[model samples]
Target: MFRLAAAAACALALGLAAAPAPTSAAERLTLTSQYGPGKPQTLLWERFAEILERERPGAYDINIVTNGALGGEKEEAEAIRLGAITGAESTIANLTTWVPLGAVLDLPFVFQDAAHIERVLEGPLGDELKAAYRAEGFETPAFIIFGARHLLGKTPLTEPGDVDGLTMRVLQSDLHVALWRSLGANPTALPITEAYTALSNGVVDAMDMTKSGFEALKLYEVAPVLTETAHIWAVGVVYFDANFWAGLDADERALFQKASEEAAAYFNEIAAEEQEAALQRAMALGASRAAVDQELWRAAVAPFVEDFVRNMEDPRAVDALEMIQEAR
Candidate 1:
């Protein structure tokens, strides 16, 4: 019995020694988002993390903190730029606060359609934006096209005239405020986190948001009317801290590049599905929709677009618009 016990102990020790230990702890990177799980942007980050793990197993331990666990858009963008947090999913409107050239993309009707968007993203415009953002401590790896922004209201709101004299919830960007003001609305800049509550309490009568966000935040319940302005397609980026990016070696950078491209393609594909489903979900929840004469909205904003480009702080804003127009 003693001999058998000793033999068992020796065999167990040998087996443990034969097994290989883990190479090293995976590099920890945390990404922030204002959307929770099942939302498009949150899914985009999850897809990105999955691709990284697939390409280099055990090399990256990526954590996606959702529903603004880190902060809202403005705070998260600042965090990424400061390297206080590793990364975040952010919009061009948010970045325009830092890089004014980004406002070109925010112009109404800049993107004619999906194919036009594809041309611009695959063209020199993306490269230009990437370089510009890198100068501002953000290493923008991927460009994503989210759903278009539309007007939402508790009342049956439909045309450019409908928003006139209404208190509107605008993004935490001056550009959004200026755009809504041009339409004759009283624009008030507010973080998306406060949009629902503001709408609930009559602080704001109308607001603009993407289809997916309208559904994800259940703003459809508060503002039960959706006007499909399809004004500006929400172009967003996977922004990483430039310092964090600089610390990566060539091989690691290559993995990130590949992962970003794959994940972006994945996002654009499913985002359309999510947008369609969002409307259906909203309708089921007692929401109503109105069709807009898009050409009218386009005409209304044409002058504002021109003025916005002219007054932009960045000279390259003109060049950015030229690239997008050339692509079209």
Candidate 2:
């Protein structure tokens, strides 16, 4: 869905495309990713860059850094706040530290399906969350999704009790920890950069992440069983450094905002295709796919979801969750 020409179609060939070259005489800015070249998010960054190139010629040189070279999403976000880095994407769970309103998005089973997610996030509720993001020093221009997360392990983990006693690698979010803890897994908060070695060396028994993330990092090579939990929708923001945004002129900010909208919409349009393709690749590589019992999972997590909303430090999170459910 990108405007790149036929010859540039390789950009979406799953791991074949690199970010386009930086524009000429443009102010250098970093757009970091926890993935390498050819991944969808990397391509999202490339798409963002191309829009800037066409609309604000010679105004920005959005340098793409992949493979957690700038550390994980949390580090990248910290750097952005310090103005040490320009931008990166982060899940709503990861943003909970600064914006408790993110809790609404992280609730399990809140999103019924991809269409439900698109309707809620692309509608008024999303705009409210973006304003919350801005209040916390994150200039979120686009809401991108990383697909739903599933468990990856050496054996099928298709039920709530199946995860008992398993060591799972999770992002550095307390909510994520609580989610796993409630399911009886000992969750380790690790930066994604170490997931491969951790899983390879048996430091962890399994992990949960989006299929594209597992495929992009080749994590399926180590954890060959993917359980389709679809518990969380995994929405995130393609955000800018608040400090950088503060310095840009109104016209400049408008240009970049427009580009973010277009690129993110394109990203959403292709998210499913990318996930399905990534799952196929993982399966072809001798990985096993398992299905979760939907009723079982829903019942198991319903109480926690309720408690989570009730205890949210930011009262706005409850309102946001209500808005999402009402929209659904």
Candidate 3:
């Protein structure tokens, strides 16, 4: 009888101990991007969110904010720094705040193809760049390469001569300014959000942006001609604030990093496919698309590249340029 009673007591104790505690809700994380939802940037974030939810369960959740709804890239970056936001997908141009040396990546014609970009960015050099951001109080999970930048204009641009005396909208980067100036176009730096209106209002006759950006911004509606000059292959970095990152336990951090890298690879593959699709879609929408004369663009931009190389004091910048050229 005593044995039976003891067994019952033990079973009851086990049952009480095994009862699950209330599952805490997942912590919601917000990721801000300059592009609109349904675009490439937001698509990457969505994939990341899915992976995070699957891997971390109740650990973390991601909410993507796009279309400058949270403000422009610069503003969003500042928010991340101030701990007002958790993460952001930012262009190298905007990332210049944390790592000024990153601006070198914006130079025209530096990265020849996606393979070349991937090799450099996922290799030792890319690791170094990631560390640079870490030093500035951020966590860089992975860098994703986008399609090559091309010139889209209201007027046809087959060669450098066509751009002469044209007012061109460019990102506020010294490298971009130098490249545009060398090509004889008047360079005006403006935020990406204002680019569409500026183009429609005739504030700028030409702009350099990826084919996907052209489609997303509906720039094709106004600028009917897109020249595949392929001047620059831009890259976007996924970053988290160091404080928020450090708060995560080891397993959570590993899960986030793995998910981010996978999402970045997915973004690169999708971006390549979308680049051709965007061009085809533009043509269907009554836009004329053509390839630029490489020789002419190279000739016009060579001097600018030379000047840039001479002025750059960072050996890593020079090495990155050379490595990319060699890979090409």
Candidate 4:
């Protein structure tokens, strides 16, 4: 019996030795964003990956692709839908193509401030948006503010009337087109990739973007005039591939969610500060800056906002709009 037991132990040891060794690190997953390295959008995910790896070492490996290495924003969104990629930092405006109800968030003058945005998005309205995104097979775990969008124009845009007859580069989103048309501007739809050339060649006299966006794209070099329209507070939606998310165990998923939220909060606090600094730097670099009558701009766009909410298909849009307007 002792010899038999020793033989069994030897057999077990040999079998264990023959088996493949366990991997020390997890397989890497991809995270794609249009923003290239050193951009704030990419920096958010950089921080997220760092936190995730530090907290759950060897459990998750994230390979981040910036500068639209995988594809443009719309293409990346489709990849997420098809499970071709793990996740993307998509603009809320571009996401409208998949989830049309998301356009409500792009409505001009909808949000009061970052605090107001947080309150509405973290509460019932946010819940509804999440459900809407999930219905379309995507999930947004967190939202990062880009900053209040302003007008960057070769000509000064100090008031709503200044936009009249000007050719402006608007986002490809439907709502953006409609908003600019309502303001009496000849809206030209252009991708960010083509915006610099269009601005330089005088194809478009004006364009709207946040301070960071202007700095990232170096638009101020061409447009030269920064008008603080604060028309809309642009936000980046953190979208995860639903199938990829479902494949993860509960613990792994929780780590992702926690990291996203923590990274979002960290960036949110500094977004405003960065916007201010970006504007200062642009001015120092020879760009002119001016402030518009925000009240007049809001009033000019009020009709469009009212019509947008009234025409929304989602029953939640009404409540969401109300909730945002009423948020302190």
Question: Per-residue CA lDDT of candidate 4, range 74-190, in tens?
Answer: 666766776666787777898887777778778888888887788878888778777878878887889878789999998789888899998989887888888888889999987
Residues 1-328 of candidate 2: C-alpha lDDT, one tens digit per residue:
2212321332232123235665466687778777778777777889989988888678876678787776677767776776666788778788888887777887888888777887888788888888887887889988888899888999999989999999999978878899899999999989989999999999999999888877878888999989999888898888988879989999889988998888788777776678878888988988878998878998999999888888988777778888889877
Q: For residue 63, give model 3's deviation from the true position in Å.
A: 2.0
lDDT, candidate 3, 1-328, per-residue tens: 6334444543343344332433667586777667877788888889999898777576764566677665566666666666666888878777775686687778777776788888777677788888888888778998988788899998779888888899999886666777788878999988788899899999999998899888888899989899988888888788998888988889888988998899998888888889978878878988888876787888778788878876765656777677667666
Mark the 10 consecutive residues where model 1 has the least summed lDDT: 10-19
Global lDDT of each candidate: 0.82, 0.82, 0.79, 0.79
The residue-by-residue lDDT of candidate 1 on 172-208, one tens digit each, is: 7778899999989999888788899999999999999
lDDT of 2 at 127: 85
lDDT of 1: 0.82
| Candidate 4 pairs with clashing backbones | none
TM-score of each: 0.90, 0.90, 0.88, 0.88
| Lowest summed lDDT window (length 10), candidate 2 | 1-10
Count the clashes in each prediction: 0, 1, 0, 0
Which regions of candidate 4 deviate over 4 angstroms? 1-25
Model 1 residue 208 CA deviation (Å) reads 0.8
Give me the displacement of residue 101 in model 3, in angstroms.
2.1
Better TM-score candidate (2, 4): 2
Tell me which residue pairs clash in candidate 3: none
Evaluated against the true structure, the overall lDDT of model 4 is 0.79
> Of the pair 1 and 4, which is ahead by lDDT?
1
